[model samples]
Target: MKAATFFDGIGWREGVVELVDGGARLRDEVPATGIPRLDGVVVGGFTDHHVHLQLVDHSQLACSRLGRVVDLGGDPDVVQRLAVHPVRIEFAGAFLAAPGGYPSDRAWAPDGSVREIADADAAAAAVTEMAEAGASCIKVTSNSVAGPVFTDELLRTVVELAADRGLLVVAHAEGAGESERVIRLGAARLAHAPFTERLDDDQIARQSASASWISTLAIHDDPARAVAIDNVRRFHTAGGTVLYGTDLGNGPMPVDLSPREIAALREAGLDDAALLRALSPVDPLDPDSNLLLLPGSSPAAADPLAARPLTPADLKV
Candidate 1:
């Protein structure tokens, strides 16, 4: 066991922890005697909620600050191979889209990364394929501007089938009304903050009640960025859960943590505590949690985004 100052969300407290092969686990109160002590601040594992394994230099992630990453789109085999790379991983196998929906024709999207389900009848086989491929969630697309979007029936079918399999549906909603439809259809998460249009308070309220939005705000420019930020601000204020995501493969952002993404989230009014929550999908205080140790960090939640978790070499028991 090791002892250090730990952050319990609202403030810091002296704590004891056991660093494990996977990550650190919390034990009990701090300032305990007769135990080895690690100097630094301890927090739960950080997860980048949205990423594309086929698009990013994922090799760099082994030494990056993150402890967990969720691949929102990729070839199933590619994503599964990445899961063994030290950091904990969850993935949505491929982008479920209409026959010709977005990313299907994009040069950057490798073949087999987009699963086009033209009819609701194909939904079960699609979900089963991903689930069997070790997928933790299902990604559906509704980008009417790019191509044929999902019919309401198709989206509902996917959502229901995914739910039955105990998976959450993460939707890439880019066109007008697409996000609204995704939210009402019981999708558990939005792949990106809505950037196409500003959401009314009522819509924001409705969204906050059912789904969490991943903040990929830095990927947008101008009107889109501002619109996304505004939507996030209102949604958060309305009690929405915001997950810190970089959309890692979409741009030239850092492979590990993106300061720009953190800045955008700050602009959206997430203070240090909220930022910590965004970084972590599970409570850091739990004994089963994967933890991050930022050496010499005080309890004030200061400069946390700058931390690089212990690399695979350092974390190897």
Candidate 2:
């Protein structure tokens, strides 16, 4: 099970991944195996930290070897079942929003997936419900361009409630200064790559210091592609943590590793080291699954859509 390239710390470390009947291991190269042959790295076993798993067709995603998924925004019960199911899923259940805010009217978002809370008590209750339902984190929607946005106060309540419940809060931040607003309040992750607003050096530094961002650049649509790329570029330059996310069910994105999205991240200055961390599955609930095996050579800096397969390599003990 020798892999030509695999994620190690900041960059790819070439190595051999050995798998036994019950466990796995990785070393310098292919070691003598009692078994006659080795499987190539598992394609698609990587974690997608931000995805609308409930909205996606499982078959398409299952086609690739996706080992686990982190549903960024969806119903808690649904996410809970997903977590318990065989797929090895993690989730940030529901979009905590102001009453009647964005996605409340979106055709794609269902009622269960949108939990609207007007004050701290209701926010706390909703937060508890999601936590009890076994959610790994909370997701907030602050997409001002789509509809009414949450007031600073209500957003704070959601953050506070999430903290009380020991869950991280991830936000769909958009429009002017929205990214700053969330980062300032201790949001742990951004569901979408920033697009509508340009962040300054200070702001990028602040976000880098505070939160991780999921890159859904391909869904930005061509008109706003450059803006998304530039936002990610600056964020990466500032040493911000960026996660690879496809927002899978949002549009016509590939159900698996999106080459275009990878290219977009590379264009935005995410070098090989940064790129590997962004794609690795290291979510809290999923403390195992030591490695993500992307078979084949990494894409050249120029071509972004170079990722081919994900292999299930040996787990670190």
- Taking all chains together, each candidate's TM-score versus the true structure is 0.89, 0.81
lDDT of 1 by residue, 21-106 (tens): 65556765755567666656777657899988778777887677777899988889777876434578889998898998887989
* After superposition, candidate 1 runs with Cα above 4 Å error: 8-13, 17-26, 33-39, 281-291, 310-317
Whose lDDT is greatest here? Answer: 1
Q: Estimate every model's Cα lDDT from 0 to 1.
A: 0.82, 0.69
Measured on C-alpha atoms, candidate 2 has an lDDT of 0.69
Off by over 4 Å in 2: 1-16, 22-44, 83-87, 281-317
Clashing pairs in 1: 14-30, 15-30
RMSD of 2: 4.9
Error of 1 at 260 (Å): 0.4
